[model samples]
Target: MNVSKLKKGVLLAAGLGTRLVPYSKEMPKEMLPIFEGLKGRVFLKPIIQKIYEQLYDAGVREFCFIVGRGKRAIEDHFTPDWAFVEYLERNGKEEYSSLLREFYSKVESSYIAWVNQPVPRGTAHAVYMAKTFVGDDFFFAAAADNVFIGENVPQKLAELHEKRSTPILAVKRVNDPRKYGIIIGREIEDRIYEVEGIVEKPKTPISNLANTSLYVFPPEIFKAIEETKPSVRGEIEITDSIQILLSREIKFLAYESQADWVDTGTWETFFRAIALSLKHSGGHNIVFDVLEALREK
Candidate 1:
């Protein structure tokens, strides 16, 4: 039983977010609030926090967030503020702040780190920045834009990687290949696929399996990235790097995300992510609440 032991995670959060515009001009989109609520008092958990929490719960404690300029808010949000906690206690607002205190403690307990990229590069380049942190160990890589639901999908990827001893990718079956990275692979069994190649937004449709940008990779990928050439988009593509692995006869596999893979990169997708989260939590106000929330904003 060779279970993959992926202990570290690399989150690519350095995108310039031109699509997000005016709001993203100052703050990194990762730091934007998914929803503000009272954790006793008002608590604002940013989109990246939800992303990190999901991976943290999946048994990844040591993390490197690949960030760029204007991302200090993300770093500050992760920093433990003991003095603020003490202020609440001194003012006898301890009960009101307990949940936040615990939340901060959970985050502080983990070894979360930040690495800055000089510029906004493609996802692969952002991940390449983590080479010094990841070394040669197998690590999980996920883009911050993906807001996944339910129990540990990283665990699912890890388990499959363990059995197959191959790199694992999380994917979902979608109708449009033009909209996502299409995976061309042969099914070994059921939903499990032995990926032969992957193309980024293909003109001609390949399999409708969309790569969710959630992956468990062998350290060798850093070398592949180094060898990769910049694409027509003028950024190094992870798919190009993965092609190197396939070219070398390395076995790469894809795992179907049992839960939905929600894209939270743009305003529209972010809104949908919030709605889905509320709906999945069985809150009856999902429809009106999400709509009104969007309207009011």
Candidate 2:
């Protein structure tokens, strides 16, 4: 089984962010900004942008963004605004303009498509919508609202897939596994597991390995998702799709990473993501400065 290096990428950003109310009411939650700074300039970028950049850095070029209604903001944001970059340059904000310019360069060089979901569905359905976009190639898929903050899980996952030639799930060890889709597997090697089963938000405690919603899946996953039926919640869960493949004796592997997974879906986690990003930029003091400025305002 020869699995070539993944080139196509799919980003699921179509979910309605009910957990985040007013802030996400108008804007997609994936558009929420997180701290990013370089060379004495502290700034913020949408988490989706960060995710895209990470995937781009990992060698993914052809891209598809699964979007739903009220997600025009995502498309607009991904569009390169050379005029804005030029305006910043004219204003002597070269550092800031350079960042945008770099992002724009990536955007221009890639093949990006926006596929509308119209009605919000679960992750399985969102991924199924990209079947044509992915074609026969193995591709990387991720939830756009998340940013894995440490080591490059995407790069590692791809490398793992090259050797194992199986579907790969980026897993992480957490204290509480009840909230996430937990994996039951046997360790084949250090930080790698041969996945036996997956339990979504299990009541009875399972393993600490939690699915991180980042995957390197073969095109067969689309077929698995197609065979998957809707769950009790009337949503086509990706966990169910994985179970389908498992029952068919298809091997899946989980990569437990050291990356700090930051989920910016709710108010609490959103702010926590900001703090974590600030820390990553070595600008932890900027958080206090922003707070003081807000206090004065």
Candidate 3:
């Protein structure tokens, strides 16, 4: 794999999503529904597809999905059923069939591979599982439980990484740094920050720049993960591993994404993500519907 190119990627979707509750019990939070419009009709696409589409659009040709035991739905959804297409055509629902065809084309254009995490480790461990797949490629890794709304997020990140020639993390200024991994750094360029320190959920807001869990890492990251010690939660954290890299004076750049990321860690944000995703899907009334539903409650 070319160091300058990002042709491979990984999606960490193995989390139990305890906060997403009863609904996530049977399904992965990454499988949560979002309103998408294709060929002039609104479609309910899982959050994973939303993530995949963005990466695919950014020129990723291969993907490795880190999933747990109950994520069979994800596999089934990606598998194209030619018989079903014939059935839809026989029933005169050719438009929906075309939608399926369009979806099949995307799957054909890219390679999809899955690795069972089997257990819920930390996010770093989840990413580590894809090391063999990543091999020597500098690849993009994203937390699949998020919906990112932006005009050209991945493209922009790729451009930044190409210019910097090192690991680049997507970061943003947030009011609550306590709930996130804060990047302690000084702005080297306009929106790029040279990472000096990273503390996971600090007591005080030293820096409002929070790690969005979107990274472009080189193959050397596996070595960093191998040297990292587990946290108090008994899980290997990517932040800690990156911190080790920083402590060694290795350069890590943070790119402030001009995107609104909606994580499924909470119900409110999930709904907001569905609404906000409409702007990318051409147009929709899901945002208004979400507002009305919340108003009634």
| Better lDDT candidate (1, 3) | 3
Could you tell me which 10 consecutive residues in candidate 3 have the lowest summed lDDT?
Answer: 1-10
Tens-digit per-residue lDDT, 1-297, candidate 2:
323488889999999999997777889999999888688767889999999988888888899999998889999999999999999999999888999999999999999999999997789999999999999988999999978885678888878887777899999888888988899999989988999999888888689899899998888899999898888879898998998888889999999888788778889988889888888877899768889999998
**Residue pairs in steric clash, candidate 1?**
none
Specify the highest-lDDT model's number: 2
TM-scores, each model vs. reference: 0.88, 0.94, 0.90
Better of 1 and 2 by TM-score: 2
Per-residue lDDT for 1-297 in model 1, tens only?
323466789998888888898989888887766543343233345667877877776677799999988888888878878788888889998774685687687787789888999797688898899999999898999988786765468878777766776789998988788988888989988789999899999999978999998998899999999999999989899999999999999889998777866877789987876666655555536567778999999
The best-first sequence of candidates by lDDT reads: 2, 3, 1
Worst 10 residues of 2 by lDDT: 1-10
Arrange candidates, best TM-score first.
Answer: 2, 3, 1
Error of 2 at 216 (Å): 0.5
For model 1 the local lDDT of residue 158 reads 72
Q: How would you encode candidate 3's per-residue C-alpha lDDT over 11-126 as one tens digit per residue?
A: 99899988877888878888888877677677777888878888787788899999998889898888989899989999999988887887888988889999999998898899
Best of the two (2, 3) by TM-score: 2
- Candidate 2 similarity to native, TM-score: 0.94
The all-Cα superposition gives candidate 2 an RMSD in Å to the true structure of: 2.5
